[model samples]
Target: MSLKSLIQGQKPLTISIISFLLMLALVIVIGLFGGRHIIGYLEGQLVAHGIDHNQEVIAGMQPILERGLQDGAAVSVIVSNFQSFIEHAEPFGIRLFLVDRKAGRVLADSQNRAAFPYPLNQLLDSMPRQLNGAPIHDLANWDGNAWRRTASGSVELISLHDLVVPANREERWALGVSSDLSELLVLMDSLHLHLDVVLLITYGLIGLLGFLVLRWVGRRYEAGLEQQVAERTRELEQAQERLIDQARLATIGQTASVLAHEMRNPLASIKLALSGVSRSEGLADREKQRVDLVLGEVDRLEGMLSQTLDYVRPVVRDEQPVVLDDLLDKVLGLEEELLSEKKLRLVRSKCPQCPPLRMDREKMQQVLLNLLKNAQEASPDGGEIQVSLEADDKKLVLTITNQGPAPAQEVLDRACDFFFTTKARGTGLGLGLVKRVVEEHGGSVQLGSASGKVLVTIVLPTAD
Candidate 1:
């Protein structure tokens, strides 16, 4: 799969893990480059130091050769003396050679007397003319058998060719010194091994720390996205609820108008019959009293029917600017007696910053009264009821809470459904009407139960 597809298919934690692996690869690359640079730098220093040591050896051996030549000693005697010096030296791997410059032949060798005349022709053939009285250095590797059969390794070779005039003699000699560089190579190898271990540890630690940081940032990002999704879902649900409420209101309006028109005629005929019977002289007093009771029952039924029809009637809004706090005060004053009878404590919290809102005053009053009455009925005597109004830049929120036995989950779920109620005598249209009125005003209503209390929340958009 492509990288984008792989990443998209993974969870947040899995993405973090992938980032850690990439970081490890980066660390490996950095470690390799760093190790190579460090080893190269060390090898350069070792080679430079070896060249300087080889030049010093050439200087030290030149004086010995000059003294032997001034004394008229044979080349063999000089070679034997050099051999003796090499045997007593601390660094035994050094080799010295003395050669005749004109004839290009070895005159004395510290490594072997039998190797005299040992192909100085090749050594001189490659040497530069006009040495400027300074030594020339080069590096070469040799097999162990060629030298003293001791070891095979590389060496720094320093060659000096100059005209030397001993007393009563003029001769040209080329002096050469070979310094073993095996120890320097060994040191480089050791440094490389140690560097490898150190770089491995350093990269490992860095990779681990990077992984942890990525994991933390990934979790935080995931949490923020989740919160945003939840908030958006809530807003969409509120919008859907408002649409449903509007549709329900329209359906109820059409149905109730027809039903009420039909029921009114029958209710009027029943009232006329009861009135005629009560006035009849042929009837006994007990019968007349019975007619009176029937008339009272008819009036009660008529009142309930009228209320239901009124609830379903299409809302005619007389929109005006009204202060929310003032509106609440007026509604609470109207319910003073009922609240006092139940001994219910009323707590009010209002936001001072709430602006005037445009809505139908009479309809809004009805909505508030219905909700308060429900709260009062559900609350026990001496229970507390809380009413709070809060506002933000976009909306106004009102909440009414009453301390009481919570309603069943099923009842809460269908609280806004027409003719759905928990009370035995309730018509179940109160909350449905409230929901319709609120939705008509571009608002939403939510009913919930928690902690043995009923909560009703209303959210209304602020005036643009």
Candidate 2:
């Protein structure tokens, strides 16, 4: 896939991986250059330490060798004495060498460490030239390194400030000591191994921490995005609900207009004519019964038309602050006889300190009465109907719960829809009208049915 799409598709996962990879690459780059610098520094330190160790061995031998040569002691004997001294004195792989340049011969050699082309790789000079060149002799001068091949065919890196011994007779002598570089090589190898371990651990920790932190940030970002999406979805659903209600009201108005102008007048005329005939004293009992049946059917049709027109009618409110508990008492009194006939029990609860709500008294009465009827109808004989009211500073809530067989989820969802009724003789517009009135008063309605109970809840604004 293209990079942008991959990043956008699973932003949290993809971005975390990318961040970790980039951090890993950065760590690797830093380790490479930093590791090189560390190793170079370590190598230089090892070499310097070896040189200092070799110089110490030379210092001890200098005084004894000069006195022995000037006192006419044999050069061979002096070389032997110093070699034994250093082997027991300084604990290192130090070798001593002496050459007779004038006799064109080796004077004394310890370990056969270096062969005749002496100082073959001489790299620096910092010692006395000779009395023959005139001027003062700088006794503490230090020379630089030299490379040589031993008779055994191995190579050694050697450093010595040339020690000029006084000439005895016609033979001139050169004396110095060299330290084998093998120890330096071994130290560098060990140092390199340690550096590798340190770099591995350092970068490994950085990669792990960087990945965890980056992943956490990405997840948090994704969570924020998800919350925003959910909020927008809720807003869209609310907008759609408003649009559907508007469309439904428009359709109902058109149908209501047709029924009022067309069928309502004819049905009224038919009912009036039938009533007049049925009242005629000349009619027999059989004729009177048939006329009354026709009139009854006419009355039913007219009732249906009136119900539809009422539901489709626009609401006009005379709003005032009304106490809900008193209204509820009167509505309950009207249904007392009906509740008694059905063997139903009424249960009421209200907040004692509840405030009055700003609403249309007539419209709210209709809403409460219709809800009470639904609760009464849904309950089995001897079952309970619970009416509850609660009030807060911002709003007032009313709830009615009826004991009944559990309803389907779809029924609860469309419970307040226009003309949606489960009753055999229902016009299906009762709850629809209730919802319209409540919404007109800037309130809301909710219906739920579950576990052998049906519940309806209404919320209205409190008085300003």
Q: Which candidate tops TM-score? A: 2
In model 1, state the lDDT of residue 363: 79
Q: lDDT per residue, candidate 2, 372-412, as tens digits?
A: 88888888999999999998668888889999887788988
Candidate 1: where are CA atoms >4 Å away? Answer: 1-37, 48-98, 107-151, 157-177, 208-320, 333-355, 358-360, 376-406, 417-419, 424-429, 433-464
Q: Write the per-residue lDDT of candidate 1 for residues 243-304, one digit (tens) a residue.
A: 77667766777666776787778878998998998999999999999999998878866776
TM-score of model 1 (CA atoms): 0.59
Clashing pairs in 2: none
The C-alpha TM-scores of every prediction are: 0.59, 0.61
> Model 2 reaches what TM-score against the true structure?
0.61
lDDT of each: 0.75, 0.73
